[model samples]
Target: MNDNFENLFENSEYSKTIKKGQLIEASVIEITDDHAVLNAGLKSESFVGLNQFKNPGGEIEIEVGDSVKVVIEEIENGDGTTRLSRQKAKNETTWSNIIRAMNEDEIIEGHIQTRVKGGFTVLIDQINAFLPGSLVDVRPVRDTQYLEGTVSEFKIIKAERKTNNIVVSRKGALQGDSLENKSEIISKLTEGQIIEGIVKNLTDYGAFIDLGGLDGLLHITDIAWKKIKHPSEILSMADKVKVKIISIDREKFRVSLGLKQLDEDPWKKIISNYEIGNKIDCMISNITDYGLFVEIEEGIEGLVHVSEINWTNSNPNPYKIANIGDQVTVMILDIDNEKRRVSLGIKQCKDNPWDSFANNNNIGDKITGKIKSITDFGIFVELDGEIDGLIHISDISWNNEDNIDLSQYKKSDEIESSILAIEAKRQRISLGIKQLNKDVFMEFNQSNSKGSIVKGIISEVDEKNALVLIENEIKGILNISEVSRDKVEDMRTVFKQNDEIEAKIIGSDKKNRTLKLSIKAKEEKEEREAIDSYKADEKESISKTSLGELLKSKFKKD
Candidate 1:
């Protein structure tokens, strides 16, 4: 060997110890169109493909003196050249990262390259790993092509060196990051902080607002100062709204928001603007079976219960009287500040019809009305001012000792009656059709009480009893036994309809309007009178005979 060659070998890394399957640090010496020359502290420089030094962006990133890790494939090939592999060197490092991430539950970065069977191919460092479709995101993704060539963090769930198998979850890494970010966000939140955000989603009870990357709940009750049925009533999806933070729970990552807090609470000004008996014109926002909910102002409302809807009607139907969005005048009946409640009355806004009627009319005044309805107990007559007067069944007729056929009157039938009573506060008006004429019932009842002998005409006869008309208006019931002082098995044989018969008044029922008559009692009373008369006449005759006999004896002695 020459002196120059001997000195070169002594100073070169080739003599320092080089072997195949060994990783060593190398530096770029020169670059060409297709390849780069690297020096691994060896006597001879080796060539590497330029594509190996190119970054994922397809840009040539190599420069002179750039240190790289390369594995020796052969220290000396048949051509007497050093052979090294860059990809193999990177594979060893990639395995180390994957094993560490799996064992320590750490996150690693990867580039999603392409779609594969049942998953995507992720390049972690330089090693290929399987990323399942379900692991791409926190939620299911219909299209994963958008993730290609993008760098994302991942958690290695499984790894096997023998088969070179590795599995990673992007969702797991994202969830971990979300938890940390959520904690930071919640910790910084202060209650009552007004924030502008976009509405993310709406449910029946609330809406979820996106405060930057964090989500907060806006309950339906807090969405507006007025009552609402759902969150959608005031907000929609993706609507931009300013909300106030009502509450925050850092540990649970929960935040309560209120949209109405952005505006002045209308209830705070309610007392200043309204008081009991204050009449306000407003629109009916909602109508339920029980009441009408009217808006006093924006975000302020009052309830008018069915009872307060009218003054004359005992059971006023809310739906029948009003509808949603109807303009109406209501008087404030009560106010509850703490509960944010107001009791209202539709009838209080105007003069009560009952009171007006009472003031305008007097008892016994003649009234013309149309029958509004007929019930079992009474007939409702619609009188003046749409007010109704009840004509009870008992007051409907003066001659219904038998019965008054209610079918004679119908709805919208015009009739005349006299006002019997007026109870304004109780919301009742009593009328009597019989009062338009004389009350023969009262006179007949007074004149012929119990034990009074009265002549009556038989109006009806049945197997059990007979009906007889007294004073041509009142009728009394005469049982079969009362017809005669005998065991009468069949009342039909003893009496018939339209037959004239005299009887004594035995009993009376004012509620049922019945008078019991008895022919047997009348006959017994007549017999007693005749016996008393006969006894008085017989005693007078005896006294006269005794006086005549004494006078005749005294005349014979003279």
Candidate 2:
């Protein structure tokens, strides 16, 4: 028996020397409920905990005659057994893999185990590695809990077996994958290609979409056919959407995407769908100081300018008449297809009161209306059917006076007037209240003649002349030299308002409606008549009496 044992020991695989902390290949010799026996080139069979050979779910993964790599923790023990560890073996192998990955610039898979100070701890196989917060992902992670227990690929940036230090980067791996994806996507990308993507972020000018590992810009204008102030109005973060590729820059890795290009342009057939003067119902979409924007159809809108809101009001307030979300009827006045603009008018759908009024009335037609508004220059009269006619201050009376106050014609006061003119294009009506009466100058011209005596009252007096009101409302002028047949410095001193006086008309201008009166000529004519009468009396007395009786009367008078 002794001779047979020596022969077996000399040829056995464990006859070679083995040391602790050394890795060696082993084979499972036996397995039990609590322990596993492994032949690891040792003098005696090594025993390890059975749990080491079991998976996380407590299921045995190793059986008899199965091969595995193990680390020797003890060469010999007092119990006549060698100590071996499967976990230690796995940890050493994991460190070797990580170091190799770092050298070869390869990626390894790992699970984020837990968050630690300044970073997170990741478990790769059975070894723990450090993952800095900055290297976790391409974007900053607000909550580290989200990454816990999640399996992700990582790039080993550093590895040290002496100090048991290892560092990995998720961001580096993602960046490498992104570069590959970007290059491939750019090579295959063509204009007009439809693709799906997730909305990554939104900005004032546009939205960024993520197509797998690449990012593209979706401009705000391409979001829809209608006008939008921002991209958030139509899309939100992380929304999935289908978009068309508009352009691509290979060198810059820039892509432009469009969502509206997938649909037909609404303005392409606008002319065929709508015509001038066609009435349509629309909803107010927006309001501005200049006009109202009404949407006639989806993605199609027209402008109802302030001037087109009403016939009478040239400067109408669009907000006062309509608001956002209000429905209204409008007429298509004009359309420019190339510009994609439609000029709409709310009043065009209704009866134009000015046009109707002009058709019914002619020049010199008498009409009665209420004063709608009064100003220093004119008064606006509201006629029938909401038509307004302007009665200028000069047309209010026969006299042309600059200081004619229009305050007397209050708003809503009844007044009679005649239409003098109509400007259809400008939507203006000229009216005259004084035109209802005959012109006073025409009557005065028929009765008065030059060099005729007339009586008048001083209506206005100035330094140069006195304005006199003659018969039939005729106005006359008397110069200062003609006042009282005497030289006068100022006519205002010789004449007072409403003073009655007699004078001779020296000049009469029928066209100008002016009569020139002279008091000096009248006084001179009366003086000459008195002298002639005295001469006639003296001649008769002399003829009746005699030369001697006349001499004696002269001597007595002396």
Residue lDDT tens for model 1, 148-207? 989999977667688788878898788774777777777778998988888755656688
Question: In candidate 2, how many Å is residue 152 off?
Answer: 16
**Candidate 1: deviation at residue 462, Å?**
10
Error of 1 at 541 (Å): 6.0
Model 2 worst lDDT run, 10 consecutive residues: 1-10
Instruction: Per model, state how many residue pairs clash.
Output: 1, 0
Q: What would you estimate as the lDDT of candidate 1?
A: 0.84
List model 2 lDDT by residue over 1-558, tens digit each. 255665676577656556788888999999988988888655567888988887655789998999999998876678856789998998878888886676545689998898899898998886889998998989887877888888999987656677778888899788875556779977887899999998855667788787765678899999998888899999986799999999998887889999999999888767678899899999999999999999977788899999889888889887787779999999999998778899999988888887888788899999999988988788999887787889988888876546466667788889999999998778889999889999878676567667678898989999988999887778888888777745688877767899998988888765456788888987887889899999999999878789778889999999
Model 2 stretches astray by more than 4 angstroms: 1-178, 403-405, 456-469, 473-477, 483-502, 508-514, 522-558
Pairs that collide in candidate 1 are 458-499
Q: What is the TM-score of each candidate against the true structure?
A: 0.57, 0.60
All candidates: CA RMSD in angstroms? 25.2, 27.1
Global local distance difference test of model 2? 0.84
